[model samples]
Each structure stands twice: as C-alpha cells, then as structure tokens.
Target: MMEERKIGRKTDLRVLKTQKAIKDAFKEMVMEMDASQITVKELSERAQIHRKTFYLHYTTIEALFEDIMKDLFQEYCRLIEQTAPDAPFDEVNRVFFTFMSRQEPYMERMVCAPSYRDFSDKLFMTMMIHNRSRYNPYANYSKEEQNVINTFLCLTSVNIYRQWVKDGKVLSLEDLIELTNRLFLHGISDVRHDL
Candidate 1:
C-alpha cells in the first residue's frame, strides 16, 4: 500500500512537471511569434520533450492552446478560492485584487518585452470569447439582442482590463470588483443618478 501511494505521488509530480514544461515552452514561443504560426515540432523543441510525447498529450496545437487556457483559468479560480473565503462580492473582489497584484510583475515584463504585445490579449480572448448563441446569460434573450449583449459585455470587460493595465492604476481589487458588479447590475445613467 505504501509503495503504491509513493508511486502514485511520484507519477502525479512527474505529470505536473511535464505539463509545466510544455506550458512554459508554449508561452515562450507565443511571445516570440504569432500563436497561429507556432507548430507542434517547435513546441516540442522548446519544451525539451519528444514529438511523440507532445502528440500523446495533445491531439493538435489548438488542443494545446485550449489546455493552456484551461490551466490559466483554473489558476485564477484557485486564487479566488484561496484569497476569498467569505464568498461575498467584496471578498470576491479581494480575490481578484490579489490575483491582479500577483500578475503585475508579469504584465510589466510583457509590456517591456515588446514581443508579447498581443499574447496576453490572445490568451484572454481565447478563454473569454464565446459564440453569442452559446452564452449562458443570453439564453433567455432573443438572438439579435443576445449577439449585442455578448459583444458589449465582452468588449466592456476587455476594455476595462486594458485600460487598467495601460493606466498603471493597479486599483484596489475590491474597488474594481465593486465597480464591475455595480456597472454590470446598473447602467451608467443609474450610477450617475445614484451619485
């Protein structure tokens, strides 16, 4: 029993290490060039893993990209869970704030590097973008309205994040969350009226 447990743990660690290696390599290549231009051979070389191994893990480059996105989102969710135990909006904001705080240095590096201009955006778009018809919140809305809402909501979130990063505001995660929730629940006119 003890030997089996030890083997399982070791196998888990090895799998994690390999996954990390692939992700890091992919990030490096993405920084160097367009994601569409990256090939599995290139990824395998950068990751220092065998081509067969890459194929074994991911059926295609798109699959690998999907995996990367899933990992990033999982990390963000984990951060949320770790930083906010209360499950309230404010607490959720704190979690977001902590996650953003951790990402500050990475964003700085990405900005200074110049080569990674659209990498972050691509990652965000990959994770967040969905067909209007598939949007969960828009299930009740008409098709045309759903399309508009989907586009508006996506653009709004992306713009806010871009502006926040560009302005270097690093606003309190809590404030950001509160503002986001408020804006989401109430229109600009409503906010103005409240003020």
Candidate 2:
C-alpha cells in the first residue's frame, strides 16, 4: 500500500500483510477442499494479491504450507517442552492433546481434515522428530524398540485425536485424552471391554 522502503533486517509491513493475506486465503482453501488441490491462481485471487506478490513471499504453495507447518511444529514443541522435562510419555502426549484440543479452527482443520492427510502427516512426523530428543518412552529398550514404540504412540494418538475430531468430538476432550492414555498403557484388548 505504501512505497517499498529498505527495511534492512526487518520485514516490510506490506510484505507481512501480503503474506498474511496469502496465508489466510490458503487456509480458506484448505478448509474448503484438499490442500493438494489448491492453486496459486485461486490463492492469489482470494488474497486479492497479484501472483507476483505471492511469489515475493513464497516460491510455491508447498512452501507456504511448509511455512505454516513449521510455525505449528514450533508451537507444538514449545507446549510439549512446557511439561516436566522427565514427564512420562503418556503425560507428554497429554500435553500434545491438550495443545491440540485448544487449536483454532484453521489449525484444527490442518490436523483433522480428512482431505489434509499430507498436512497431518507432516505435523505428525515433525512431532516425532522433536520427541526423540525431548522424551524417549522406551528409554531402556533398544533403538529399534524405541522407534516402533514412539511411532505407535505418536501415530495412534494423533489418529485417535483426528477420529475424535471427525466424529464431532463425541467424547469430551478430557475423556479422549484419558482414553488415549489408556490405549497407550493398556492396549486394545484391555480397553475393548470398556469400549
């Protein structure tokens, strides 16, 4: 809107506004359809920014998606870190679920939208990479054991959370977290009777 001035290390306000517009438009598209289907032409139109302007901020739609994912992953790691350093794995995941439960609609869609599997998968893998350093549940077990256990723990929990969201959260968030912890600790056979 204003003349572009040399802002040095700081981002131009116009640039920030344009980026936010692009991001907001992309988010709307994600909510409306699968993320993979979004195109720059539609996003630029929706953002009311020129495609050239969009390029000034992000090289590709995938880049924008990764930018958003990085912000999300950072926030997730921060929340997970806030829990006690040596917290039990279940408790650590409780922190994750709690953070997830509090997401805004756009972010919730990123995690729970059936068409956004790539988005969700990216989020899941990012969480796992960080968790390896933060909390290793199977500490006493071999690396392979830890790998499988952590994958199972992370994957099942996120999917359970995803299913819960898709089902319109039939169980309260607290109940879902409790049930997830049960599944992690007791396994399916043990929880089958309760289900």
Write the residue-wise lDDT of candidate 1 on 1-195 in tens digits. Answer: 999999999999988888888878877776667556789898899899999988878899878766765665667655644532335444543454455446644343443334444544565444334222123544688978866775566556655655676767677656676787777667676467543
Give candidate 2 regions above 4 Å deviation.
1-11
Superposed model 1: Cα runs more than 4 Å off:
1-6, 79-101, 104-151, 167-186, 189-195
Give the distance in Å from residue 176's predicted Cα in candidate 1 to where it truly belongs: 5.7
Clashing pairs in 1: none
lDDT of each: 0.62, 0.81
- Screening candidate 2 with a backbone cut-off below 3 angstroms (N, C-alpha, C), the clashing residue pairs are none
By lDDT, the best candidate is: 2
lDDT of model 2 at position 4: 42
lDDT of 2 by residue, 1-195 (tens): 243445632566777788889889988887788776899999999999888988988999889988998888989887877777678867876788888888878878877777676767877877887877765556899988877877777788788888888888889978887888887777787677653
